[model samples]
Target: MTDISPILEFLPCPTPEAWIEEARKPENLAVILVDHANNELKAAQSAMAIMSRYRTGKFGQNRGTSHSNEEKVGLQLKTDDQLSLLNKMSRLAREELRHYEQVLAIMARRDIPYVHLGAGRYAGQLSTAIRTFEPFRLVDTLIMGAFIEARSCERFAALSPWLDDELKKFYLSLLKSESRHFQDYLTLAEAINGASVADRVAIFAGIEQDAIESRDHHFCFHSGVPA
Candidate 1:
């Protein structure tokens, strides 16, 4: 496996040590694994949502336009950048879905029944900060995606060594794709915004950090300090 040290540097916020310590407990393993599977599915759905909303600009246009004609016209009107974003999000969505399946297979082997848990407050807290404007809203969304992916990668790295052999191998195998996903989101955000997203990225970084460090009543894959 490739060294993850360099890639870890790119993350705006690191997973807190307290959270990782909690995650590494044997009693928490089953819940952590189940939540992780759910997270993968959610990530795939988020990517698909972004692609659908921005791909052909159909979602952005006037409500009077017929759906069929809007799709046709939107395709014709799509800019090269929009096409690129669509392609990247498509690939990302597929990868996340595949990861979701892999996690489920692992769960099956371990006899851990899949359970749907309420989502942690981490993402919802970040969503509150998203700008309501058209392209800025999109930019904030992409930046949020970047933060989520980066934090996942960080948590994976932090938790891997403490896991059992099978889990260690699986988590290590995921680092590369998670790393790429963060970069893809960041790159697309900057490209779509036509300017450096450094300031905006920093802003989201602080928000994400707050979410990570805050006291959370529930424990899930992306949760903050365990209550």
Candidate 2:
């Protein structure tokens, strides 16, 4: 198993035992599997959304537009940065979709048909709280991505011991990659912000802790303590 101490340390609160127990119930199995698959898809979508922010042409001047030497240099630098971010998000998105495919395969073997589920409050709360300004917006989004990935990894680790052999192995495998994805997001956020994110991290940590510890009737991969 991957050493996920870093992921655990990054998270403000551990997933509640009550949630795990409720998740383990046979009655919830189908919902769990289906929701989990949905989460993977959502993860992929989030990565793409980040990539959307870095679209290449957006970094350059409009067609037939003139630029001073300094502006030209700035455009080149921004384009390079955009390309780098675009590459990272592309890989992250692809990996998430692969995980989605794996989950769907497992669900199929178990005869659990995919079903629609609503978003839980956890993501909406964090997203709505993000600062709606340049740089800060992207920074908060990346930070949010890191926390979500870290929590997912932690949850997988927490649930592994109780799962069947196939799921146990699959969840364990995800921790290594997903935890790395967590780190990737943090590194990118700090790089893009060009400053220490300690303050923002602390604030978001509190929000995440509240989201995790609050009583939530919603049952999903990222839900808080089961109500």
Candidate 3:
């Protein structure tokens, strides 16, 4: 695997030390593991949704309108770029799902019950900044994806040293794919925009940093500093 030190420098924000210290507490391990499993599934779902919406062009059509049926039937891979995007997203979705399964297996071995829990406000708060327009919205979304994956990678690296042997190995193993996921999202965003995404990236970087550094009422895999 490639050295993560260089990749960490590319991230817009670093994982907060306060959050890492809170996460290292043994009492929070179960909740963190469970939430990490859910996060993997959610990440896969989000990527799949992007493929469906953009590559297939099926997302924006009004369901109650007369054109809804036509839109649904019109889903087809149109361009080389779309095809490429579809392929990348499909692979990412599969990998993320596999990670979800891996997390579940670890949870089972540790006898940590998988229970449904509400997600933290980190994602929701970042999503609020997404533009409501077409290509711009897509660009913003992809940049947000990059930030999310980058942060996940950062957190995994930060927490790995503090975890038990099994988890430390697992998190270290995940670093490569998580790093690639961040790169893929950024690449797609730049390709789709046909321009540098640096400004938008900077905008979301501030948002992501605030979400990570601020105090939170609950602790989860991606939550900020513990309250």
Most accurate candidate by TM-score: 2
Where model 3 places Cα greater than 4 Å from the true spot, the runs are 57-78
Writing each residue's lDDT as its tens digit, candidate 2 over 1-227 gives 89999988899989999889988888887887888898889999988987775575254233564445324334332555566678888999999999999999999899888888888998887787586544556778989999989999999999888888998999999998899999988987787666778888898899999999999999988898998
Residues 2-66 of candidate 1: C-alpha lDDT, one tens digit per residue: 56664467565677788888898888898999999988989999999988887675345343534
C-alpha displacement of 16 in model 3, angstroms?
2.1
Q: Candidate 3's residue-wise lDDT over 37-122, tens digit each?
A: 98999999999988878866433633344543234434333366577778888999999999999999999999999988887998
How close is every model to the real structure, measured as TM-score?
0.88, 0.89, 0.88
Error of 2 at 115 (Å): 1.1
lDDT of each: 0.82, 0.83, 0.82
Better of 2 and 3 by TM-score: 2
Higher lDDT: candidate 2 or 3?
2
Q: If both were scored by lDDT, which would come out higher, candidate 1 or candidate 2?
A: 2
